[model samples]
Target: MFILSGLFCIPTDWHVLIITFMNAKVESWCARPEQLSDMPVSTWKQLSGQVNQTCQIKNIDWDAVTNETDISGEFGMKDCTKWEYDDSQFQSTIIGDFDLVCGRDVLIDFAQTIYFVGMIFGVLTFGILADILGRKSVLIILLLFACLTGTITSQMPNFTMFAISRVVNAFFIIGIFETHFTYCIELVGGKWSTIIGMGMEYFWVIGWLILALLGYLIRSWRSLTLLISLPSLSAVFMIWLLPESPRWLIAKGKLDQAEKILREAAIMNGKPLPDEWKLKPVKDFENTKKTTIFDLFRTRNMRGKILILYYNFFVTAFLYYGLIFNIGDLGGDVFVNFAASGFLEFPAYGAAIFVLMKCGRRIPYGTSLILSGLFLLSVSFVPRGVYYKDWPCMVLALIGKTCVTFAFGALFVYAAELVPTEIRTSAIGSASFLGRIGGTIAPWVGKLSIYHPYLPVTIFGVNALIAGLVSFLLPETQGQELPYTIEESEKLELASLIAPSILKPAKSTQPMEQEMIEFNNIPEKVEENEEDNLSCYSGDSALSQKVCS
Candidate 1:
């Protein structure tokens, strides 16, 4: 009350002083709301220099004098009868323009969370459809539908309508992300998988850079959303360029189709097929046994491994996205902070490549997770509401962000290697399903900041720590052959856990290539039996047993 009194009651001497200051400035032009649009060319040219000083206010007390008489009386304040907004700012966001202030703020978080709900739905269905229908077709369809829905979202009339449109947009967007990663990796041959995967990953970084630039230039959320999704239209046309996944075709028992795609791929690369390469018709297709989610839990050790990996995936994704969407709470230029944090991802990916190659997967994976956890924990301790608070908080946050990104990159490859080939896709699909669950819950976790500023960051810290601890239990697959079957994977559990160093796969062995060729050459029952007999006579009983098994 005293503060309000001091504010409302200005001394007579100060009033005279303020009038004198106003008299000095009264000779110059002041840009009023009514006068802004009609200003002359010369006035418009000089307005930028004078506007910031006179137009914008650092503090506003909206309730001080709400009535029209009070606005026009001694203070001469602008009347805001229906709507209120500061006209001096360069851009207007959804929250600012729609008045999504204190009472309605949860709508923002809920809107974001609803998008993730769509993503969770997408994650469950897209991978299965991709495996069944074909990667190219699914990707094209997603691109078309996502582009359509995203454009609709931009034109929505209300927050509710906008949030609903985001759900549809998110469904197709997740499909775009998942299907494209799979399609691009399949298009590249085995020797170039790492290079192609890294290249594809760079597209996401470019996306971040583009988003930052667009947000700065296009302040309207509707315009920005449209611009961000416009690239999907281009993707729709890429149907002509993208080929179906040969590996997927082969798994679906379409050997002839797979062969045709691979032959075309070989021709495109200017690499002649091996003189011995032949498209033998596959009779006994191995893909007859359709793996289900239950397959992941059929065995005890496998179940434990899958559960642990899924937990790690969930925690890693939860913390990673929780930090990303909560950037507004850190108190700075949100664009600059988001861009700065996103820019670190490039170096993070590069570092991931280096560390994975030199040190191995587990070291980089576990260490990155632990370091990220520690950094986030440190962020919780930084003194808030003081000078230089943002600097320390931002630094720690960005560092944590980079580490989590690096760990995420490693986790993708590590998870693929941990599971056997027969159910590799299913295992990864399950892990991703869990990850999406975590992502869906992340925005709600971010809202906990309203209760306590430290709560969100502390949750991130705890998740990262838990993920880091669980990652150690995963076996290292560095320099080891990926297991092809359940029995083979079972044989490696003891060795993988006990002495991974003792079992180095021979470089001379081309088991993956051999496996591919062997699957392609599936023969008649009689011929297969004869081949088994020949293999027995040739003293390669283990190979025969493996093939027969």
Candidate 2:
């Protein structure tokens, strides 16, 4: 399973890079001024290539116009970064000076807008079906549609048709990316869940990295999309080899099939099945209860669920997407910027791995988001010459990129952990659906700030701020067990809410080494996550065991 997800890295980065690549060119073109009417014939000759090219807008003074406004926020900086796009209205969506870029941007603009629409709607529809059907069935459906639609979308005949296809492809395909955490949780025992499930998304950066490289080579979003599109078919075939979710099977009373999947896992792990692994008669999860929308809203604890989802949806999409689309605005080598930006992501995944085990969720998740926001704000204030200079801007941009990557990695587990298993997938699916709203709006955010680089910083900063505060509203899921149901998972501090505080929570400043030694001793991946959680449970026992007699 990890291997398949690792493979997904190629296309995932490809998706971001290609999209970013497209967005960069249109933005850079818009930032420049109109060229002189009586320019040299040699310059006119330069106009020859620009005239008909789908991307280039002919006869523009790209240089003078950039002075009128700073697109990268740091008015004077230029550097390496990642984040990228084209379609006419779509072009306008991200950059308002649409006229300057020629009409080619209209098609690019529409394509991205339509694609996001497809993404938003596709997640909801697929999630409902996922809850009704087993996870495995929906897996096949999403993969098939993803494979066929993604491949077909690549061959779109015209701009209008292609834009519509982006929506369709996004709708059918995005459900899988959104559902991965839930599906992984169901597949593994509690112990191995966080690293394996969330770790898969780190490799997603690898997909963006690939596209960054490809942007240097292929230079077209269409070709880049086409290149990765081939993998969906293979993904369908590869996933067919995977086992179904046993928990889902048991929920539907398909105990026999559930056991079969479990046996496969046991064999894969080379471990003997527990005695309780034997298949038995089962009953449906919905046997005695009503499952409805109100169920998600009725509980006080569920409100936390809503808060986390909305925060994640908006923050992840807004900061991550907005910045990527705006990367080219910094006025540097597009390929270098994209690659350097992507390279920042490698450390983020490693940081997440350490933080998830040692630091717990709240600090890592909350602080990273706040830091990302702070950096964006910092970029706005950095003196143009000192901060906006090539290396300086690159350094800041990379720092900003790293923070978002960390937040995203943490959210995979944090979001999934917020809800109970029954509605967990649906919750994640819904939040992610709305999260793509940030993605939908990001291009517009970029476009609106065409002349002002600091505009996106303000916009993304607010998003980061909202996400960080809302994160505080959520329970600390780090030391907590994965909730079996929404009820079991959250012990709403109602009593403490109203009652006088008994004791203030103590801060731990114990050296990091003690924790590292305990962490390093774990023999298996499952043992690490499980031990961290179980060790929390065995607080007294663990302390006693370590005590000197």
What lDDT, from 0 to 1, does candidate 1 have? 0.57
- In candidate 1, position 499 carries an lDDT of 46
Per-residue lDDT of 282-338 in model 1, one digit per residue for the tens? 224554466555666778777777887899889888877877766445555756754
Cand. 1 TM to true fold: 0.73
Best by lDDT: 2
- Clashing residue pairs, backbone N/CA/C < 3 A, model 1: none
lDDT of 2: 0.58
**Per-structure clash totals for the candidates:** 0, 38
- CA RMSD of all predictions: 13.8, 11.1
Task: Indicate the TM-score of model 2.
Answer: 0.73
Whole-model lDDT per candidate: 0.57, 0.58
